[model samples]
Target: MSATRSALPRQALVFLAFGLVQLALDTAIYVGLTAAGLPVATGNVAGRIAGACLGFWLNGRYTFAEGGKTRLQRRHLLRFILAWCALTVMSTYLLASIVTGTSLQISWFAKPLVEAVMAAIGFVVWRQWVYR
Candidate 1:
């Protein structure tokens, strides 16, 4: 039991490393698109999709290394997609609403923050359901 419990932090660290890499890639893509004059919402959505693909690959091979090619992997990815879709809609709407409704003027930063929250949530769901 002690050995099993000790592995959790190591696994979490692996997950965090992969997640940060994924976030960096996604942020680069989003920023590039926005700099090229793409609208924030469009660019954000595109970045999220790209990130999800990379994340799925990383999580499947590394984060949940023990469960690759198993039924749990499939279920995890599917549920992740579902959860992401829901969060994406909520985050996008909330960010957009905040941008439009307030004088905060930090539109450039809001999407990344939202994505980070969504990613964290996704990690939890994936760890619990898919990688358990």
Candidate 2:
């Protein structure tokens, strides 16, 4: 029982570590595209797509791999794509709203904040549904 309890936190820690990397990649792409005068929605979608690809592989192989082995099956990828699509829509909408309601300068900071919130929700969904 104790081992099982510990496993959740340990897994969450690993997930968070990988999430940080994904966030950096996502943010960099978003900033670059937005700075180039691309629409916030376009930039957000592009960044999220890139991040999701890396995140799916990283989280699967390291954070949620069964028996400490990297074994990503087709179903996992399918589920991840579905979940990623939903999350991307939500994040892009939120980011775009922030940009319209505020300013691009503010949206630059808001991007990470929005993604951090999404990441929190993502961790649970990925653990319970996507990876499982």
- Whole-model Cα lDDT of every candidate shown, in order: 0.70, 0.88
lDDT of 2 by residue, 60-120 (tens): 8988876777737899999988888888989988988898899988989988899999999
**Lowest lDDT block of 10, candidate 2:** 1-10
lDDT of 1 by residue, 1-132 (tens): 775366578768887888788777777776778678886677667877888788777777776665234323566777778877886787667656766876234655666677777767776777766555
lDDT of 2 at 16: 89
Off by over 4 Å in 2: 2-5
Instruction: State how far residue 95 of model 2 sits from its true place (Å).
Output: 0.6
In terms of TM-score, how similar is model 2 to the real structure? 0.94
Clashes of 1: 0
- Once fitted onto the true fold, the runs of candidate 1 whose alpha carbons sit more than 4 angstroms away are 2-5, 67-73, 101-105
Clash counts per candidate, in order, are 0, 0
- Model 2 residue 128 CA deviation (Å) reads 0.2
